[model samples]
Target: MRLEQADPKRLVAESYRIEGITDGECRSIFIDWALSLPVGVDARQAIKRLLAEYRGTAPDHPMTAVLRAGLHKAPQARRRGGARGRRI
Candidate 1:
């Protein structure tokens, strides 16, 4: 996927330009990027595309690590109200 499609807001791209950016900051920026994507855009594909775009130039970047972590995290389904959610 094109960088434009993956990161329309350029949040991830801009994060790389910020010097000394921390992992927490990267994570925050990544969240912003994720939230900015158009509905129906696959976030993992976007993250992978961003990773591919930047990895060679900034493998050590905190954003890179955040993107990698984003790729690995599984979507966990949780009950909205615990056992009370169960129909008796």
Candidate 2:
């Protein structure tokens, strides 16, 4: 799905509602998601990508610095292999 096809703010609001998250928690989640993208992507683009990936679903938890770290690690993990050189 394309980022232009979805309303990211609305998606985050609805997902937060469905997940029963407090307003503060939701804001934190939104901010975290916004900051967790590739270097060249802006917050708006980050939110759009997140909305595309997580449409109709609630995030597992409020966003955090750790979540951003994991996002950074994902691409590296995809390229690296296990001890036997098998893809993880």
Candidate 3:
């Protein structure tokens, strides 16, 4: 996805401008960015692009971990079937 396609475009832009931003601050921004994502957008891919663009300049930045965490976060599994399926 292109940068413009990212949710909260202003937040993402501001995040990159932060000089020596703290881990906590990055976490907050990350949450905003995540929440702003549009449906059907590949979060992992979006994050990867952001990481590559920003993290490339500072691989050790605290934001890297936060973004990486988002990429690796697994979706929760939904339970199916009704009580009738149980061994009664």
Judging by TM-score against the true structure, name the best candidate: 1
Task: List per-prediction Cα lDDT, in the order shown.
Answer: 0.90, 0.47, 0.78
Who wins the lDDT comparison? 1
Q: Looking at candidate 2, what is the lDDT of residue 67?
A: 32
| Candidate number that wins on lDDT, 1 or 2 | 1
Error of 2 at 73 (Å): 30
| Clashing residue pair totals per candidate (backbone < 3 A) | 0, 0, 0
Better of 2 and 3 by TM-score: 3
lDDT of 1: 0.90
Q: What would the TM-scores of all predictions be?
A: 0.83, 0.33, 0.70
State the weakest 10-residue window (summed lDDT) of model 3.
4-13
lDDT by residue for model 3 (1-88), tens = 7776754466766876789899899899988888888888888888887877777787787887888888775888876578865646
Displacement of residue 11 (Cα, Å) in model 3 is 1.8
Q: Model 2 segments beyond 4 Å from truth?
A: 1-19, 33-38, 58-88
Task: Give the Å error, residue 69, model 3.
Answer: 1.6
lDDT of 1 by residue, 24-52 (tens): 89888888888889998999998889999
Looking at model 2, residue 35 earns an lDDT score of 50
Number of backbone clashes in candidate 2: 0
